[model samples]
Target: MRAHRIALWLAVGQLACSPGRARTSSSPEPAAPVVVPAPTRETPRAIEPPPTVTVVSPPAAVEPTTPQVDATLIEGPAAPAPASPAQHARLLDSPEDPEPKLRGGIVKELEDVSYIVGNEWSLDAFREVITGLGGGYVGVGPDQAYLMMGWQRPEFAWLIDYDPKVMRVHAMYHALLRHCGSRKEFLAAFEPEATDAIAEVLDDAVADDRVRRLYRNNRDMFRWRLRSIERKLARRRVPSWLTDDETYVFVRELVLGGRVRALRVNLLDDLGMVGIGDAARELGVVVRVVYVSNAEEYWEQYAPQFERNLAALPSDARSLLLRTRLVWQVNRDYVYNAQPLQDFLAWLAAPGVETLEDVVGPKPPAQRDRINFVLTTARPP
Candidate 1:
């Protein structure tokens, strides 16, 4: 595999230099020495709320661990902890791995952001819908945060993925933003700084609490995350815009002023670590939107757990579950695809539908299909 990759890369390199083929902005030639701004103490302006008026509470003290939910953690007067940028930086010091509650309680599979370069054509549509629905989002998947960057403009974004490597990737991003001020310097230093010997990186960050803890306990995890990011870049995941320092600053500025965060949270957590409802209440805002991607398509068998998770999230009439759909599964007739589905479900919950066997088969769509499926609490239960 290594040899094959080397040969393929060599071919690509040759193509880049081979001829007088005029390159577009998407494909650039050699890079020039770009001067990225040094880390600045620039205070970011407060992000204004979206059309639907989403909100979150003030920043609180960063917690040191993800202890399993207890009485004090779950229903207390203290609102759910905001997934602040500074709060995530605190995870850099986690002494051990934070584990997601798995079904079998066994490690059967492990991977995140597999360096796959493909047509993520739905990203534009996802961004459009979420932006239209307004903000306050928590999503599941690796790097989907990048997908929602410009448009979603969320008040709070929780980028949750199942894989530890995925969370580590996010952590590396956290470290970068905490350290670098502008794009050019970030592009130059991110890999080198994060991937260096743990001791060396720690020396510069001696005063940072998160940095010190990361150096002490979670150094190996940080190294793997840095390596994964570099691999993704080699596979061309890094966009051309990020290459230009000016554009980098421009894009980053448009994204929330350090309000987003990345973390390891499962959709099936019994107590709900990615507590959308809890956070919303704590932040004094409604969680108007959520992006589950196609997770439901593959994990629908765990519906009981997933349903409980959703029920726990604080939602209202305006809230919507943004999901995709498979073409084959969509019903052309019912149109319960919108409000009626919830009504039909409410009916089924009562005892009257027991005699009707016809309602058992054909159903709603999956989120990954050409026409994605969305869920809303349009009908009063």
Candidate 2:
């Protein structure tokens, strides 16, 4: 029995000491790392590298086409309203006033009447006649006459004298009577209180050169009769040489009224007569002639033919015919236009025209021709 016990103990000890048996507790061994082959055409397999991770970045973003909606999205404030129709209607309804009419026939008659003359009278004689008749004359040439007049006065004058040639004065008087309304109306308007005034002036007339000439010409007889009528009207002793013609009274009235200035013919129209030596004798007024050579040469050739027909005119009548020479020159030169002359003449006829510096100022030589051209073209009948 003792032998058996000892063998058993030895077996147990041998089992515990066995080489494949665990003697103490321990964790199981990890499995061996698996080996994978690279992918091949036939036996494709994925090979992973030793835990090496790779990071990939994404692409950049793009913007949208439509605008983004706002957080509030309510409609904006409304626009202001337009103006009303009543305001526009009120602006268009206002009215305008009428203008006054001008005195026409009188102005027309004054423009139409012109003086004419023949060659027999000296310029001085012609001027005296004009002055006596209460008109102003400016001699433009040896044969020419320039007469000017204004409203309310005899701006121009002519005397009725017997002339075998031209008979212009007779024609003028008849034309004036026909065209300027009745002689009675003209006489009354122009020579108010004529008889009384005539008698007074004749009584005061002395034996001066003017008085002597008046007597020698039978003007004294005419004046005596005129003064007798005036004295009877005035109940006073009247002088002779005062009453000559009713026209004389008409003229005297103009002079006394300061409507006329008795200028010498040689002083106002003849440019040749206007130098320092003779100018002082010409009185304060001066005259100038503007000859347009271009037209004058042409007219000179034809003027003689017309002169025979014109020769029978009185000296005053002939003077008027000569003044028309400028008109002919302008017509021949083709520089004539009627409107500007009419406008200028109209301006001249306006009240106080004498005081306008621009109208009466000294003109340049170049401009004088232009003025002549305009005047010749524009003068009324």
Candidate 3:
């Protein structure tokens, strides 16, 4: 397999260099040099709420369903704790081994900016299942990540996506979360009237040139998406990080404390996925929940590396895997699915388990909020 990959990569390199093909700016840029910023303290601006609005108190934290397992320290010299948010962000980058290249022709070749907001429609369905299983998080996409991370209050979060544009939007999210004190202020920054505020925040918080440039270029679209998210959360009456003060503060602290990291990492990549597992282990953080957001729909069969990556994550009996599938037979949008990590691994290991449909079945439960399922069995936990 190693020899075959080397030969294939050599062929790709020849093609890349031999042609007169002009590369487009839409392609993901090469990794940037690490620059840790000096830590500075600033009190967030406090904003008052409207007279009619009522704030919901965040629920008390819940104990893990199972006992926590301590991570056995990696047998090597230990690194000192990171001093700043930038330093922590640097830790989440792809590891040096396996060279961090993507599969499937740059791993999902489409580079257009993502739906900066999610289309999942019913993330609230996951609130009870995922809440308070705090450890570390690995997931894809934009706002949906924040929602799950907020509910779980994970010790750290790595928002991994194949698209660099998605990473740029997440960069913007980090900056906005860092600067905005109140939920009102955070959502307001996405409005046209807050251009100056947004500029100040972006200029100070985001250091990567490519991330800042791309984000500014598509600010309008992002602003629209974020505002739409707030409207949807309100219309649904779902208490979220945007709608609740306590949830907002928790997510804000994760960002400000430098525990939230967003990066481009393909799930099937040997480097990034393994790197996430190793990083989590070194930090002594269990990956309690992983939200893939319908990414499985893109592939018909699981790659060998996919199995390896899932195994590498340090999980316990209580650990959960969350995904959404557009089972049109149930709802026009998506049906949220959650499974115990152990059960999911068992299903993946079973013979003839080729795709999501093989595991989740041809149709989801008619009551869309359901979670547990066997290869052909669906049941409520």
lDDT for each candidate structure: 0.37, 0.22, 0.57
- Residue 274 of model 2, lDDT score: 26
**lDDT of candidate 2 at residue 250, scale 0 to 100:** 40
By lDDT rank, best first, the candidates go: 3, 1, 2
Q: Give stretches of model 2 more than 4 Å off.
A: 1-203, 206-210, 220-252, 263-381
Instruction: Flag regions of model 1 displaced more than 4 Å.
Output: 1-121, 132-134, 180-258, 300-302, 325-381
Clashes of each: 9, 19, 0
Ranking by TM-score: 3, 1, 2
TM-score of 3: 0.69
290: Cα error in model 3, Å: 0.7
* Best prediction by lDDT: 3
Q: How would you encode candidate 1's per-residue C-alpha lDDT over 1-381 as one tens digit per residue?
A: 333443343232110001111122323222111111123344212121111111111111111121121111111121123446644443222222245333221012211212111112233333334443434566654444554543344455666655443444455455554466775555555333554644354446443333434333333332333343334332333332233343344335433254565655667665434354566556555556666654443332334556556655566665656543223112111111122223323434544333112222233322221223222332322
Residues 205-269, model 3: lDDT tens digits: 77765555555544554555456556756655555677777778778877777677776677777
- Per TM-score, the best of the predicted structures is 3
What digit string (tens of lDDT, one per residue) describes model 2 on residues 246-290?
Answer: 333343333333322122211112222222213222222211211
